[model samples]
Target: MNTKIYCLEQCFLPKNWELLLSAVKNVAGFCKESGKYDIPTLPVKLGHSLSKCAKVLRTKAIMEDNEDVKKSVEGFLKLYEDEWNERISVKARQTLYDAKFN
Candidate 1:
C-alpha cells in the first residue's frame, strides 16, 4: 500500500500520464499482496487515508482529461472496495465468538 501511495504521488506531475498509469497498476498489485496476507483487521484511520488517496487520484485523473488514468482509478476503486469489505471489526469478531460459544 505504501508503494501504491508513493506511485500515486508520482502521478501528480503535469503531463506524466505514464506515471499515473504505473501508480494505478501498483495499487492493484498492492491489493493483491494484501489479500495473500489475509489480514484480519485494518486500522480505521489507515482505511480512511487510503480511501481519501483514491478519491484524490480519481478526481485528478478526471480533471486532467485522461481516460486511461480514469480507468486505472476505477480499478483502484474496485480493489479498495474488496479490501475494505474483507476487513474485520471488533464487533464482528465478538459476534463470531458468540456464535461459536453458544
Candidate 2:
C-alpha cells in the first residue's frame, strides 16, 4: 500500500464493513513498512486520529485490493465492531436526550 493513503484531510471510516476492512488492510500494510524514524509511529498516530474523528462518520470509499497484510487488520476488525457500535450508541442517546429535553 502506498503511504499516501494517510494523506487524507479527514478520517475514512465507512459504514460498510467491507470498505472499512479494506481501509484497515491498507493501514496495516502501511504500518508494516519501515519508517524513516527510529520508531514505527504510523500505527499509533493513525489509530488515534481515526478513533478521535470517526464517531459521526458515515461515508463511502473505494476498496483496495487484497494484500498479504491481514492478521492485524482482522484483529482490529473484531474489536472495532464493538467499539464503533458503542460510539454510535452514545451519539444516538445524546441526540435523543437533547431532542427531548433541549
Task: In angstroms, give how far residue 11 of model 1 lies from its true place.
Answer: 11
List ranges where model 1 is wrong by over 4 Å: 1-6, 9-42, 87-102
Tens digits of per-residue lDDT for model 1, 22-102? 443343333343332222232334455656886788798799998776776676566556644454233334444555687
Span of 10 residues, lowest total lDDT, candidate 1: 34-43
Q: For candidate 1, what is the TM-score?
A: 0.45
Q: What is the C-alpha RMSD of each candidate to the true structure, in Å?
A: 9.0, 14.6
**In terms of lDDT, which candidate is strongest?**
1
Q: Residue by residue across 1-102, what tens digits does model 2's lDDT show?
A: 232334332224222444443454454443224311222243345455565444322221113333222333443445465664453333334444555686
Clashing residue pairs for model 1:
none
After superposing candidate 2, which stretches have Cα over 4 Å from the reference? Answer: 1-68
Query: What's model 1's lDDT at 32?
Result: 40
